[model samples]
Target: MAGSRTKGSDTLRAAQMYYLQDLTMDAIARELRVSRSTVSRLLSTARETGLVQVQIRSPMDSAPELERAIRAKYRVDVHVVPVADSVNEVEVMERVCLQAARTIGPLVDSNAIIGVAWGATISAVSRHLTRKITHGSVIVQLNGAGNTQTTGITYASEIMRRFGNAYGARVEQFPVPAFFDQAETKKLMWRERSVLRILGLQERMTMAIFGVGSVDADVPSHVYSGGYLDEVDIDSLAASAVVGDVATVFFRADGSDAGIVLNERSSGPELALLRGVRRRICVVSGESKLNGLRGALAAGLATDLILDEATARSLVESDGAAEDAVGGFLPLDTASGR
Candidate 1:
């Protein structure tokens, strides 16, 4: 026990020198009369033992012009991840998701209810979440994952589980189809006691996290490829001039869901419900999703956005004549108001 205490003391000292004093590993090794490799191990042990915590602030402030432009134009807070022009879309997505995970970790707290919409971007973000322990917090699925070919429980549950595990929160799964065959079926299911429980939880959500789904993404969105939609559904969306979706709810390029037809059967929360959540974090990446992102922003679905620099540049550079003509987001009844 004496030896163990001494070793822990040495590890903490090494971490302080290396992180705070900015001393090199060799310097730390010499001071402690240990080999350089041992010093490295000590530093690693410090981090593993939680004796040292590292935080990387986003570089969004570095590009003040870009960040300001996005905030001014979109009316949402933006975290613009810096990605090189050389990086592929996949790499860009990885970096942006990492930033998003870090950003979300501190915002959650005990007794907070978080709503999560499952998808490619969100799944990736889930993989990168920084563990944050909380009590009485609930991570609820914002949409169902069932489809004709598969239940989609394994895929969607895994994502929710990751978030729940990371936050030390309870998981609430929405067990239903992503899109029902008939809108009437959804209407009927919404009235069920089991479904109403989840809906009631949703109305109490304090924060919501989601990714915009786009058919044209460089990396395909899960909703478009996950067997959730059939040929008829695809044809309907295309005919309706739908650009993309927030969760499973489809919307047109002008951010209007008025005649989208498909949204009537979607299990995802309505845009109004989502907007009512105190904090809405929308994570989107890749240039292919620009149209979808534009529509989502136009709808005022997001209170904050996490996106890559290139995509942000493209978005702000555009004239946005169509979205402007559509004017601002239409007012809708809130969960309680409705």
Candidate 2:
């Protein structure tokens, strides 16, 4: 037992010197009064015993070519999470969400107000967040979660609680239906002080976190599957040629929401208001969301995008194909100014 303990101690020490202290094997060997080969063995043992961990992170996460292509074409920052082609859509979301949670920490600071859109992707992301304490920071829900079937407070609150716990910040929930029965009702509600307070918070947001909603996704978007939209509403969206949504405001394939009709009653902030945010981080995964993602990009909904490698590759390929067919890539409004 004593001999094993001594060997473990030696391995741990060698690993600290080499990895943490940046000491070369020669220096470690000399300091320990042992041979370079022995030092190498100790380092190897450290790794084998789980005393040392090495992570290789590329400038673009893992897909530099794809990220660069997307960035150049979309005029937005891109991070492509490395995921195997054969992985299932659920697994893809898990990986992308994990990476997004890690990436989000650095973009926030003291007194930052963060707008969080609750959806399947964002919910998954909330589960993986690493604690990042910030003073006077607030995490506010970007859209209402209530529908005819449920209040949605429980589901949305759980997601918000995770973020609040992670950041040690306060949580603010939006109390309203995902969409009102009438546009006039929505307009009236907006005039209320309580409702206006949430909207006011949204305007002051420094960062906005969201995910594109697609009805066709393998894992259906929460808004589509959560009873937020009825058959009549779904049919309306279809007739209007809606492709996807960000924060419950649906948009067409061309990124135009003008004729969607449903926009007037949406409880979510307007695209213009979302653009006013300094940093908008959009997270997506799975090829099923490809068209929706494209619509979101064309709408200039995101300033920074985090997506899985497979989705990123598909995005690049489809865009290139569209550019070929159109003779050029179409210019976007880029409301957030990239």
Model 1: per-residue Cα lDDT over 154-177, one tens digit each: 999999999999989999999899
- Candidate 2 ranges with C-alpha deviation above 4 Å: 1-62, 334-338
**Candidate 1 least-lDDT 10 residues:** 329-338
lDDT of 2 by residue, 197-304 (tens): 888999999999999999999999999999899889999999999999999999877777887789999999888788788899999998999989988888888899
Q: Using Cα atoms with residue i matched to residue i, what is each candidate's TM-score against the true structure?
A: 0.80, 0.83
Clashing pairs in 2: none
Cα error, residue 17 of model 1, in Å, equals 12
The weakest ten consecutive residues by lDDT in model 2 span: 46-55
Give me the overall lDDT of model 2: 0.87
RMSD of 2: 7.0
Candidate 2: Cα lDDT at 202: 92
Cα misplacement distance, residue 142 of candidate 2 (Å) = 0.5
Whole-model Cα lDDT of every candidate shown, in order: 0.86, 0.87
